[model samples]
Target: MARPVPVNLALRDRRIDIFFAVVFSAFTVTSIISDLLPTVGVDFSQPSDNFFVQSNYWYAHDADPLFMNPPDWMRIITGLSAFVYMPFYIVLVYALLAARNWIQLPSVIYATMISSLTGIVVFGVEFFGEPEFRTQNAVKFLLFNLPYVLVPLVLLVRMRKPLPFTRRF
Candidate 1:
């Protein structure tokens, strides 16, 4: 039989946890809001010219499109995020703010699933799609998307063990 390792109720580093929570909270909130707004017309592909959409489109519509001309699958996944993942992120933000230990396992699972899906999409587009669909700058693409991948991965590692079912802060 496997022995259960004890988890500390107190956060190992309060500052880091708070920082990640704030960043992700902001990102998820913005994503949800941007996606929810009505586009300029009936075109689901044509997003409104709001700050968030414009900023995202600027990079997406570049010479070697990163997000501007995403495949149908990407669009569908993003749409799902607006409804499903956005709410999940909201819950995660609350959990993080409360320093709820119960969030550890779910956080790890979320990280793994999201990161893996992102990897599959990015790599799949790069390899299977038309050459023009590939990102113009590999390094820039990775850098831009690194946080989404890294944050969850780090959180997964940090929360590998079970945490106490109590608030830390």
Candidate 2:
């Protein structure tokens, strides 16, 4: 009889998971507070159809995008920050599901795939296009991104498992 192959739990590298958690936490929170925070004063009262269109125009031209627009470099940094949120959330939720004594591996994998794809799209837009509608976009981005930070923190606090160790320490 052929020997059975051993399953690789090495795929579950706890060190990397913890590292991701830390890095993602830092990136997401910074994006939310430092970059997007200032956007609170952005003008969003333009005509409905012109909102996003105007924002992107300014983004493309490297001009002041709105009433309280920051410099282009700042916008780039903030936009890029939005990209990492979904993957962070995905990994966090997957971690929770996996650590739960009940959920199956297939379900965890499915959740990860979905969240990873979401992160890709979020990042892809920032990569290929500049958002024109400054205030609306910033608000929507924050709404989507904040949960990633909160869910993981809450889970890490409540879960019994030692945080998946990372290379940080």
Candidate 3:
């Protein structure tokens, strides 16, 4: 038995997947440092210090409110991102880079999960939460968080066919 040859991240043949890999890798790092660490009381969410969220995500969290002082459901969502999505993201990055067919099904589930969580649940709260909970700034929310919804959908289309990496796009 022979192992499949895995391409490096910079390979041009899988341009879109390479792009996805880069974007997802960024999200993974940000999620771990900004989102996950804050959830664990790491104190990095404070804007005066942290560079990643200093002028961007911190403001969005303050504007949206659910991110900082989340309700029970939001807490569960955060936990899911931390414990579930985080590991999946790491593996997904590897699978994308390695062109592993096994990632297709998991990517499907992740696409559905993330798109719903971001596009519906998070937006629902931002748009319809009580006066105190609704987002103070809609533009920032969209700019900062839209990718969580859009990228997964793109990944879905990318993974639609069998052995997605084997096909040139």
Q: Pick the candidate with the highest lDDT.
A: 3
CA lDDT of each prediction against the hidden true structure = 0.63, 0.42, 0.76
What are the candidates' C-alpha RMSDs?
A: 4.7, 12.7, 4.2
- Pitting candidate 2 against candidate 3, the one with the higher lDDT is 3
Which pairs clash in the backbone of model 2?
55-132, 56-132
lDDT of 1 by residue, 67-161 (tens): 56555666665665577667878888778767777787778778877788766776567546677778777676776666767877877766775
Q: Candidate 1 vs candidate 3: which has greater TM-score?
A: 3
lDDT of 3 by residue, 70-93 (tens): 667776777778778888889999
- Candidate 1 residue-wise lDDT at 78: 63
Please give the TM-score that candidate 1 achieves against the real structure: 0.73
Sorted by lDDT, highest first, which candidate order results? 3, 1, 2
lDDT of 2 by residue, 1-169 (tens): 9967433233255444455456555655555554443333343334335545444344323423332344454445444444444344455545533443232343344335434433454334433446652344555454645454444444343332323222111
Count clashing pairs, candidate 1. Answer: 1
